[model samples]
Each structure stands twice: as C-alpha cells, then as structure tokens.
Target: MTAPFDDLRDESQQLDSLVAALTPEQWAAPTPAPRWTVAHQIAHLAWTDRAALLAMGDPEAFAAEVAKALAAPESFVDDGADEGAAQEPAALLARWRDGREELQEALRAAAASKAKFPWYGPPMSAASMATGRLMETWAHGEDVAEALGVERPPTGRLRHVARIGVRARDFAFAAHGLPAPDAEFRVELVGPGGELWAYGSEGAGQRVTGPALDFCLLVTQRAHRDDLAVRADGPDADRWLDIAQAFAGPPGRGRPPKGPRPGPAA
Candidate 1:
C-alpha cells in the first residue's frame, strides 16, 4: 500500500508544477470557489500547511490557534486567505513551496500511525493528516486548474481521495446535524488506469458506482454529483451522494447541475 505521505507529496508537486507556469494575470484569475482567485487557493493551502506544521510541532500552540479560529467561525478561514492573498505572486508561490516542504518533513519525522496531530476539526493521526492534505491539495488544484481552463488528467492518486470520501459518509451526515444511515454501502470505482477499486461488500444493498475521478470531484465539491456519471442505489446510498465530503469542515453545498448532467470527463 502507498503511504498517504507519499501521495501527499505527489499531489503537492503536481499542483506546484501547474502553478509554476502561471502568469501574474493567471494567478489573479477567479476560481470556482466563491470570491477566491488562483492566488487565494494557493494561499489557503500554504496557510493550512503552516497550521499543520504547528500542530505537529506544538500541540498547545496549535490548540490555541484552533480555538481562536473557532471563536470567529464565519470569517476565520476567509480572513486568513484574504491576508495571504495580499502577497505578491512570487511571494505566495515561494511560501507555498516552503510550507509544503516543511509539512512533509514534519509528518515524516513522527510515527505516523500513532502520533495524533491537532487540526481545525479534530485531532488526527499522522496518516490521516497526510491523507487530508492530499485531499485538500487535489481539491484546490481542481479550482486552480479550472481557473486556467486546463483539464488535468485523472490519476490513480484519486484512490486516496475516494477512500476518504467513502469513509466520511457518516461524518457528512453528522456534520449537517442529520443521523447517519444505518446501512453500509458498497463503493466500486473505475480508476483512471482502468483498474477496479472496491470498498465494502459486493452484496451490500446500498451501492455507489462510478469513475473514480467523478467520485473524487463530487466528494470535494469540485463538480456537482449530478454532473458526474456516478449512480447510487438504495436511499441511504443516494443521500450519501448528495452530501459526500472528503475534506474536513462543515457540510459543503455542492455545485448545481449545469444544463443536463454531463458524462464524466476522460
């Protein structure tokens, strides 16, 4: 099995390569994320990377920081982004690159399986933190890619994302103050390389099936569930599709369908 830390590094490098080629005007272009430009997306990632490093290195300080953010929930994330986005494009890029390196080193220095790291949502194991970072990188990369009108090719790394999406089914429901469904659903995805990845029992009454890319897109709120070729069987499975979120946070309002639902991107 691939380590989440390795996947996190790969995802970051992919996004970094994309951003490295962007012009100043392109860096300032708006993304699908509300009121956030390409610079804002990278800035947010950089900020989170710094916070993750703090959580790994100083639990008390990280806890205090989380408390401060939670106290002003509505503006905490936005305020951080706004502040970071004010930097010049060169500064923003260098900050992100440095933060990414620092975070990877911190995660590697610890015993990933046993060490717990503080986060905005809850304490997480190093492995989970790495996975969450990978998810965030990919999701934000989508925003950056869209802003540049460039379509990124799907990769097997999405399996990490899909696994998180499946695992977060209950969290998704609970985050919205809804009771988690009692049923266990089977998830089967066709990977970018045409390999099959299955989670849960095949005979499970509830099932979600689709291209892995689309599933990741839906879970990350990068694309509306309706826009993907994903299908859910059973009421609980269907509801999971409506609220699936891979990244930690409040329940996200996913994209609305644009015209008739389109097929999954190649």
Candidate 2:
C-alpha cells in the first residue's frame, strides 16, 4: 500500500520532468485524442488530480460540487470544461504542477491506514487511490508520448496498470450489456520480475496474459491489442476483449487505433 502511494508520487514527478523537457512546439503537438494537444493531456491529468484531492478530503461535498459545476449549460464550452479555461499554457502547467503537489500533501496528511473513497465503481482505499493515480499518470504519459512519437520507459508502476486491466476485465464484458463470463483467468507477465497476475479462472472465466506493459496499454486503449503480445486463454477470453474499460464512465467504444485490428481476446 505504501508502495502504491510512493509510486504515485514518483510517477507525478516523472511526468513533470517529461513535460519540462518538451519544447514549445512539442507542447502543442497533436495527440491521438482528437482536439487535444500535449498540453491538454497534462492539464487533464492535473484536473483529475484536483478531483481526486477533493474526493479524498470530502467525498459527499466533492460529488455535489462537481455535479453542480458540470450541470451548467455553459460548462461544455470550456473545452473539456477545463477549470483554468482562460489561462495561458504556462499558467495551466503551473496550476497542474501545484495541484499535483497539493494532492500528494493531502494524501499524505489523511489517515492512510484506514480510509476509503467512493470511486466510479468500487470503494477505493487509500492504496487503491494511489494505484489509480499511477494508472492515470502512465496513461496520460502515453498520450504525451504518442503526440511526440517517442517511447516512454516502462517501470514498476506498470503493475498498477496490470491490476487495473484485471479489474476492467469484468467491465469490458459488461459494456455490451452481456453477462460477464463466470470463470477465472490466470495472467502471467513475462517481465524482468516474472510477474504473476490473475483474474477469474478458466472454468470461471477468460484469462489474459502477456508483457505487463502491453496489458496496461490494451486496457487503457492506448495501444491496439493486436499490436501487442498479450495472450488470452479459455473459451471466453475473446469475448472479454471487445468491451474492456479502464476509465470510469458509461460503457464507451474507444476509437480503433488508426486501422482495423483484433481487440483483446474474449
């Protein structure tokens, strides 16, 4: 648990370092996400951190305030409803950095030993939030990389991504209004650490396996499943792949990568 938060702090710092290295032109580069520049991705991550901070401090109030703000008709015009709508890029970056630091401070100050917050689905403990933060940082980091056409160095935080992939397996299946397969799937990551992860079993459900980084990328929709070495076993594996969702929201069909390809195995 401590490792998850520590990893979150580390990832945030890394993201800052990565952003700082970008030239002005690079900052404005277009990403795979239509209408979003690299700066926009960073701003979004900052915004999400702010949301997580509010949720940690006061879940009920946070939910209420967010609902009130987003309920406005004019909210959509803010371009993804960015809180720092009128700010310059530098100002937005500063706000994002400051907000991330504030979130870290708040997370540290709270009683980490016994705290749980309502997430999009599960009641996430402090540890889960830390892992969630890691997942987000890495995912958004990918957005920056895709924009710049540079590869990022995958690290231990990938385990967080892998964990999210497992959790999203059920969501992936249910996205199409289909019953999730009732079986257990053993997932193995052929990493330097030889990581062993699993979800439902073969008789219980489908199994997903491959390099940890690919698993994360597949679930995040950052990389097409076919481009990666991920392997799914069991009868239902292929079915699960079509609808996996990592982010919280109503079931969404992410745009296929630039071309047609096979999705995760059911």
Off by over 4 Å in 1: 261-266
* TM-scores, all models, native as reference: 0.94, 0.84
lDDT by residue (138-170, candidate 1, tens digit) is: 999999999998889998888889998999889
lDDT of each: 0.88, 0.72
Stretches of candidate 2 above 4 Å error? 65-86, 192-205, 253-255, 258-266
Report the C-alpha lDDT of model 2 over 39-116, residue by residue, as the tens digit.
778877877787788788788977775565457534432354245534566787798889888877776666446778
Best by TM-score: 1
